[model samples]
Target: MSAATLAAADSATMLRRYLLRMRRYPSLTVLLVGMPVLLLLLFVHVFGGTLGAGLPGGALPGADGRGRYLDFVTPALVVAAAIGAAQGTAISVAMDRTTGIVARFRTMAISPVSVLAGHVLGSVVQSVLAMGVLLVAAVALGYRPGAGFAGWVALAGFLVLLSLALTWLCLALGLLSDSVETASNLPMPLLLLPFLGSGFVPVESMPAGLRWFAAHQPATPVIETVRGLLDGRADAGTAATAVAWCAVLALAGWAWSLRLFRRTTTG
Candidate 1:
């Protein structure tokens, strides 16, 4: 077989390995999916009424505050779910590195790209599954979106891109960590980006400085794009900005991970 075929086969094998790991040790997957669902319930049931009232247009006609807030916050929670999964990816990568599995792989004829690509693909799948659960929870909790089939397709595409970007970055963080605990901690800051951005509330509601920061931050555009796509009113400019941010992040993380992987494994 050719080198490319070997790499593809190796990557698939690695992906299956991680997937089986996820099936066997399901607690982490539960936590990753559960956290966002819990948050969705809390925000929509507990805080939705008051928060919905504060939205620019107020509650939708004939709908209660909780319902209105559900529609608005679901997108943000979806993004949060994706962000939360990155921590899991980082920890898994770090575990493989520290457990000597990665070192063993280094001695074999396995393709180097296959190792990292496997982690990336596995994490992306995990993240997408988590997002699906979150969305289902949102719909059950009175969250109604205006998006049609095309809008759903666009939303899925954007999410996959965003997931790829985040997964790559977390993979790099995992490689850079000296310990699994450190790897777990490094991705924690990413979870805060949504809260700091236009996730929970509109940027206009924030203070002047924070509003400026929130508008400019990468997460805000991403959140907005998701929100807009769900509402079927996505701005071309915002979508472009979100795509650009994802591209830059993915490239940076891919380069960083490859560099770190090469140095650590070969040196």
Candidate 2:
């Protein structure tokens, strides 16, 4: 087989291995997927009304108070789900390192790239599944949008890009950790990013310093683009910015993760 073919086969095998691990430990799966769902319920039912009523001018232009809030909140929950899965990715990678899985794989005929690719792919798959759960919960909680077929497609495309970038970054962080505990803690701040951005409320609602930071951060454009798409008010400028952020993140994460994987295996 050619080099590319061999790598492909090995990656598939490793992907299956990670998937099996997920299946064997259903509790971890539930916890990872359920946390965001619970957050969605709490935010929409408990806090949506007050928060929506407090929006700068009023509720979203065409939406009722709680209804408009849910539209804004659902996309953020998707982002939170992706960030939360980063913790899982870190733990799984760190565990494999500590338990000598890395060494074992090195001693085998597996392609080195396959090792990292497998974990990245598995985590992305898990992130997508978790997003599905959150979206379903959002719908059940009365979340509705005006997006048509193209808008829905765009939403899913952006989400997959976001998940892939975040998962790769987590994988790199996991490879850098000496222990699973440290790995678990390293990615915690990613979970809080949505709150700091234009997730739950408008960036303008924030204080001056925070507003500046929130408006400039990576999550804001993505969240705003998602909100706009769903509201049938998608702006080309914001969409371009969101795509640029994802591209930069994905490239940076991939480079860093590849280097870390090489260092971890060879050093």
Candidate 3:
């Protein structure tokens, strides 16, 4: 069989299965669309002043302290949609395992690859919805964007890449985790890593050890690239670094998650 034909068959199967999952549970679809807006509001109104002070605007001098804090945080929160959206896959997978949905999928004739791809696609849909909602809110809050339409598109593209990449890691962990509770905790490290990184503050403000980690960490690259794009800075930015890290995570998690997923069902 030709490799091209095999790839085409696999893509078809993946899309079919993903659409089926959407039909099976529409409530999850709602949650995915809603959560990012919730997070954005919670940050902007409740924590906006405090958090805004930290962004381009706020109380900070030299920086666009006069800028809207919501604008600064919008990208990070958009990136954060990945965490929520990706976790949906983990939670759903764990539930599927407990209820025997995965076992049923295992018994099917189509390649098991659909199981992974469906979850990723579902998560991306959720992330996109959440980001869109948050963007509207950002604009309402007087957040004038520095980037034009192209820059905005770039921002969205980055989030999608990062979202899909980290999702596999979450999938691997969800498969290995014994319960839904445990799977939820898996994202905390990834989420907090950004805070420790340059996402919220400059790396220089942190301790030497932390500064070193934040300087080289994945989230830093991702956030810096995001900030640059969102603010429309001419800098080459951190997307290159983010792409490198995403590739590493995607490769590592795909291999590791597959091993763990197979074990969970077989054992």
Off by over 4 Å in 2: 57-64
Q: List the residue pairs that clash in candidate 3.
A: 56-64, 57-65
TM-score of the candidate numbered 2? 0.95
**Candidate 3's residue-wise lDDT over 5-41, tens digit each?**
6655765676566667777877876676677678777
TM for every model, in the order presented, reads 0.97, 0.95, 0.83
Per-residue CA lDDT of model 1 for 53-154, tens digit only, reads: 888886743248788888889999999999888778999999999999999999999999999999999999999999999998888876778899999999
TM-score, candidate number 1: 0.97
What lDDT score belongs to each candidate, Candidate 1 first?
Answer: 0.92, 0.87, 0.73
Lowest lDDT sum, 10 consecutive residues, model 2, at 56-65
Regarding TM-score, does 1 or 2 come out ahead? 1
Q: What tens digits encode model 2's per-residue C-alpha lDDT throughout 1-267?
A: 999999999999999999999999878788999999999878877888778778766764333677767877998888889888867998899999999999999999878999988888898889989988888888887877789999989888988898888888898889989999999999988887899999998898889999999989998898888788777789999999989998898899899999998888888
By lDDT, who's the top model here?
1
**Candidate 1, run of 10 with poorest lDDT:** 57-66
lDDT, residue 221, model 2: 91
